[model samples]
Target: MVISLFFILPIVSIIREIGYLITSKIFGAKKSKITIGSGPKLFHLSVFEVRKYYFAYSWCSYDSLRNESKLAHIIIYASPILSNLLIALLINGLLAYELLGLPNFWNKFVFYSFYFVLFDALPIYYPDGQPSNGRVIYNLLRYGRKSDFERNDPQIDIKKTDEK
Candidate 1:
């Protein structure tokens, strides 16, 4: 139960992103969450980033994480990936558990499986299967770093990143 609860924390933390976007738009902060829509994605990207970071801080308020650092925001941006993977693994684990002749809460398994599988189909993802959010952007930028070089982030200007 304790182990299940610990892993559950990360999955549940995704709500932070949802709240902040809603917060910025409803109340307006760094800027108005919406734009004139010049038919360009960059406009939307800017708006979304602000809202995301805003909600990310909301996560902090929720005792979700210590703070919403640039790196943390990147993780928050890639949260859906973690969440999607978490759900898939959970479903697979549950199914495997059943196959192994163990028992779990059937109602919970059925409910989570359907939602997670559907969420896995959102309009995200870059050329790679990962979402085109801060975390994957960070990964692409810091592609060849050593394993110890851990804090990869896209909060830095992507335009300044050099391809090796």
Candidate 2:
């Protein structure tokens, strides 16, 4: 319990700091740059990682709301740190519940492990209403948008990629 906090705290801090920098230096002077007068979004991005494939960025504004429905090449990239934090906290919660002190800790371990795995299986862009199959497969599995069947299990080996 005590030791776990030690690890998670620093990571949280570092991730936040990095997020600030990236959103500033990288995201640059854009239309959807955080908030100024009105304040942040209602259910907007807190943190996301997008498995490293969500670097492309594009923004879209809505007619009804003041906020723009901005979607990145990868939705997960919207808030990487927050995503990591959620995963970490879930892990800690599982640990505290299942392994604070128990003899047969494996039962809890296996059970909690699925939470991690299944959450991961949410498919990078496969959240709820994803428009395209941009790594995250939650597109077709949603309600509003139709799915784009564009997936390719590219054939490449370690030695081949390393040459570049």
Candidate 3:
């Protein structure tokens, strides 16, 4: 369980973020980054960042898309959920066919993957007010844009600087 929580979960989270990064790039995001974990910065290489709490939480961000469209935005938001679902299905299929060993570890991995998919696919706002991917997709389809709360919310501007 400890290994599943620390090792497996973080790996699954990273995979989920990669889904976002890939879809965002495919839609022509000017800049895309994946930050795995939270808290103080540990190290960052190009588009990947590892934080002090390397197993706590992870997220992906990107600048505005060059080929921006409703469909693109919807896909970008849904990518993580889809990725997790796909992984869970693949692993489950392998397990069903007895094509993989270590059934216990694989089962835990599949469980966590599906766990992520369920929550991410739920249309609800988090306690911090961030909307889940499902909520974002819902708004896109129903209102043709982000909800008014999102549009009216203050956004932080993160900029890179060159230091001598």
Candidate 4:
């Protein structure tokens, strides 16, 4: 449980956030960042930040995209879910073939990876009004843009800074 909670969970969270970072970069986001965990900052380097409670939560933020289009937004929103799913599938396939060692560890990792994917793919708004990736994707397809609440939600949209 300890290994699953701290080691496997945080690694899976980072992988999920990397999905967002990579897709946002592909879409030409001028600035992008991945914040892992919550609470006070532990350290940050380049586009990644690790907080004190390093497995509690994680998120990705980016400035405006150069190719700002509905399709791009939809894909970006779906990236994390896709990434987690892909990892889970790949791991499961390997396990099925008995191609990887440390079966127990791999099983735990696969479980957490799917757990993240399942929750992230659910189309629901969080308590703080932040929409899940699935919710954002649904809105993008149904309305051609983020909903009014998402537009104003600080958690969803990173405020632009004047710093160079």
lDDT of every model, 2 decimals: 0.38, 0.34, 0.82, 0.82
Tens digits of per-residue lDDT, candidate 3, 1-164, equal: 79987899999999899999999999998778888877778899999988888888888877678877889988988899999999999999999999999999999999999999999989897776667888888888887876312221122432322111
Candidate number with the higher TM-score (1 or 3): 3
Please give the lDDT score for candidate 3: 0.82
The lowest-lDDT stretch of 10 consecutive residues in candidate 1 is: 145-154
**lDDT against true structure, model 2:** 0.34
lDDT of 4: 0.82
**Model 2: runs farther than 4 Å from truth?**
9-13, 16-24, 29-164
Backbone clashes per model, in order?
1, 11, 0, 0
Candidate 1 segments exceeding 4 Å error: 1-68, 99-131, 134-136, 139-164
What are the TM-scores, per candidate, against the unseen true structure?
0.29, 0.24, 0.88, 0.87
Candidate 4 similarity to native, TM-score: 0.87
Clashing residue pairs, backbone N/CA/C < 3 A, model 1: 20-55
The Cα error of candidate 1 at residue 46, in Å, is 24
